[model samples]
Target: MSVTREKILELGENLIRTKGYNAFSYQDISSELGIKNAAVHYYFPSKENLGTSIVKTNIQRFEEMVDNMHSRKFDEWQQLDSFIKIYVKSYREQKKCLVGSLSPDYSTLSDTTKQELKRMIDIILKWLTELLDSGRAKNMFNYNDDPTSKALTIFSSLVASLQLSGIVEKVDYKSFCQSILDDLKP
Candidate 1:
């Protein structure tokens, strides 16, 4: 991608995560990046196009991260820890994950953006479900609920906690994450 295109994506993603998808405009991106509003339109064509592309790009990066973990032969525990770390990185940056950021605006988003958002969420859920199932079988994680349910619970907790930390005072983000891991400990 050209530097301008890549910068647009980065800024767009940051805006969506920090401010809701509906909160920012092409003007916001254009002003921050010193580009013309038409330039953003040239790359994304429309707000829906930019939103969809942002989610799709995040999904692609996430898949690559998972593949890297698999290649390194990360154990079930290690895999999960790494996954949680993604949220921690977002927390440190004071930004919500793409799913958390876009969910509240789901009703208003274009069909294409909604579809991409759901696909991104499903991808995470599937990975987490498989991780929980495998970990339980290997005695790496201790959880009573079915893998899918547990996956939902864990994913919800992580997203909620990250968003909550942003608004509430004195939230120990790392400890909160560790407690999630603690719940899975045998």
Candidate 2:
């Protein structure tokens, strides 16, 4: 892909992750990229088209990162932290997880875009549950219920922290997440 096109997609992802899919326009991306609206259209054609590509790239990069971590023999605890690290990077960049941020726009999104987002999130859930199960087997994590449920709880808690910070004044998502992770320790 062209460098200009890549810059457009990166900016689009940043915009969607921060402002939301509906909250931004091609003009927003163009202005950020120092390109004209027609240049963005030449690459993406429509907001939906740009959004679809961004989601696909996010999913691909996330899956590949997890796969690489697995191949490197990262233990369950390390894998879990690696997962959290991805969200931390997002929080540092825009103060929200990619999927957690986009989820509010699901109902308004195109069907294909919704499916891609769902797939991306499903991968996160799957990896989390697998890590939780492994941690349980190794007695590294403590939870009375099943790993799947616990995984959802962990994910939901983080999202709530993120949303709360966005809603209330100064909720501190990273500190909240670290506190939860501390409690989850055995």
Candidate 3:
């Protein structure tokens, strides 16, 4: 990506995570990046285009992150902790998960954006499923009644934990993550 394009995408991701997708505009990105609104248009012709681009890039980035984790040879439990950290990174930065941040606005999303969002979510869920499967196989995790449900619950909990932390913030996110990890322990 051109520096300008990358700048817009990075800023756009942060903006969307901080503000809802419907709440941000190219003008917001343009102003923050010290560029003109039309310049933002030059990179992404429409808001949907920009949103879809963010979704696509986020999906790619997340897939690459998981791939990197796999290469590190983390056992299933360790990988699960690392996976929680992936989502926690955003929370620690006071931003939202890329996919979870879109949930409330899902009904309003453009078809293409919605599809990309689903794709991003599916990728994470699939990785979680595989990890859980591995953990079960190794007797490191005992929850196997429904692997997919467990994956979804863990993800949904992490997402909720971040959102809830933003609200009352009564509990630490790391502790929240550990609770999920504990449940998986055999």
Candidate 4:
């Protein structure tokens, strides 16, 4: 991404996390970035456009991380563990996941942003489903729900943990994530 685009994305992500989708404006990003509103417009012509771009960028990054995990020689359970570890480490360092932070305000976002967010969720669910299926194949997972639904549950759990960590006790986020992963073990 261009430097300008990166700046916009960084600012927008922070704004969306600290505020909410409707609480932020292009002017907020432009003013924070020391740029013209037209410059922000050049990158993302509308608030919906900017939010869609943000969600798409974050989703692609997450999918890439999952792809990296898949390329490893680890078993499905190990791969899922590694994926959760990545999120925990990221939260420990950055205090939030870009997508995780945006999720709470999802219901109030534009249709375009909402669709983009759903796409991200689908990508995560797809990865989890594949991993869960592999684990079931190896008799390592014994969930009563279908793989897809179980994957969604796991995804929801992870996101909820991150949110709770941010609000309750930031220092306990890693431990909380570890406990969640431990509970996932068969």
Candidate 5:
């Protein structure tokens, strides 16, 4: 990617994560980057294109994280911890995860962007479900629900927690994460 393209993606992603997808315009990115609106348009002809690209990029980064964890031979506990850390980082940054950020505006997204968003969500959910299942089998994590259900619960909680952090003052995300970890203890 060219320097300008890379900067556009970074700024676009930050805008989408901090503000809802519908909350920003190409002008927001263009102004911040000291580039003309036409430059952003040249890279991404439409807001939908930019939105789809951002979602796809997030999916790529997430898959890479999962692969890295597997390569390092992270156990189920370590995997779960690592996953939680992603949300914790987002909370500390006062930005929602890509999925959480886009979900509120999901009804208005273009079909292409919606498809990419679902694919991104499915990838994360599948990984979490498998990890939770493996953890339970290994007696590393305990929960009553099926692995998929439990994974959804955990994922939902993490996403909701980030949103809550924005509205509800003095939210202790670290303590919130530890409670999640504790809930998984046998």
Candidate 6:
């Protein structure tokens, strides 16, 4: 990506995390970057376009993380713990996951952006589904429900937990997630 586009994505991601999707504007990004509104427009013609780009970038990063987790020489449960650890560490540093920050504002987002968000959610869900399926096959997990649905439930809970952590003051996300992991123990 061009430096300008990367800068815009970074600013937009931060602004969206701090202020929410509907709360920030193109002017907000331009002002923060000390650039003109027209210049911001030159990169992203519309707010929806910028929003879609942000979601796409976040999804790409998430996929990369999942890939890294898979490549690690760990057992399935260990990999899941590693994934949760990555989230907790990122939340400790960034205050919110980029995709989790967008969840609440999804209703007001454009169709394209909403679809992008759904795709990101699906990616996480799919990862969980495969893990659960593999674990069940190996007698590592005892769940009987469809893996996809169960995965969605776990994924949704994690996202909600992260968002709740972001809303609280001086919260220990690692502890919160550890409790979640404890509950999901199998």
lDDT (Cα, tens digit) per residue for candidate 5, span 1-186 = 889988999999999999889999999998999989999999999999999999998899999999999999999999999999999999988899888899999999999999999999899999999999999999999999999999999999999999889999988899999999999999
For 1-186, candidate 2 gives per-residue lDDT tens digits of 899999998888888777888899998988887889999999988787888899999889988988898899998878877777766676566566667777888888888888898888788788899888888888898878788888888887776566666678765757866776786688
Per-model lDDT: 0.93, 0.81, 0.86, 0.78, 0.93, 0.80
Candidate 5's TM-score: 0.98
lDDT tens digits, residue span 74-126, model 3: 78877788878876787789888887788989999999999999998999899
- Candidate 4's displacement at residue 53, Å, is 0.5
Between which residue pairs do clashes occur in model 2? none
Residue 76 C-alpha lDDT in model 1 = 92
- Which portions of model 2 miss their true places by more than 4 Å? none
Q: What does candidate 1's lDDT look like per residue over 1-186, in tens digits?
A: 888989999999999999999999999999999889999999999999989999999999999999999999999999999999999899989999889999999999999999988899999999999999999999989999999999999999998987888889988888999999999999
Residue 134 miss distance in model 5 (angstroms) = 0.4
| Superposition TM-score, candidate 3 onto the true structure | 0.95
Q: TM-score of every model? A: 0.98, 0.91, 0.95, 0.83, 0.98, 0.86
Count of clashes in candidate 1:
0
- Lowest summed lDDT over 10 consecutive residues: which window, candidate 2? 86-95
Worst-scoring 10-residue span by lDDT in model 4: 90-99
Q: Which of candidates 3 and 5 is the stronger one according to TM-score?
A: 5
At residue 155, what lDDT does model 1 achieve?
98
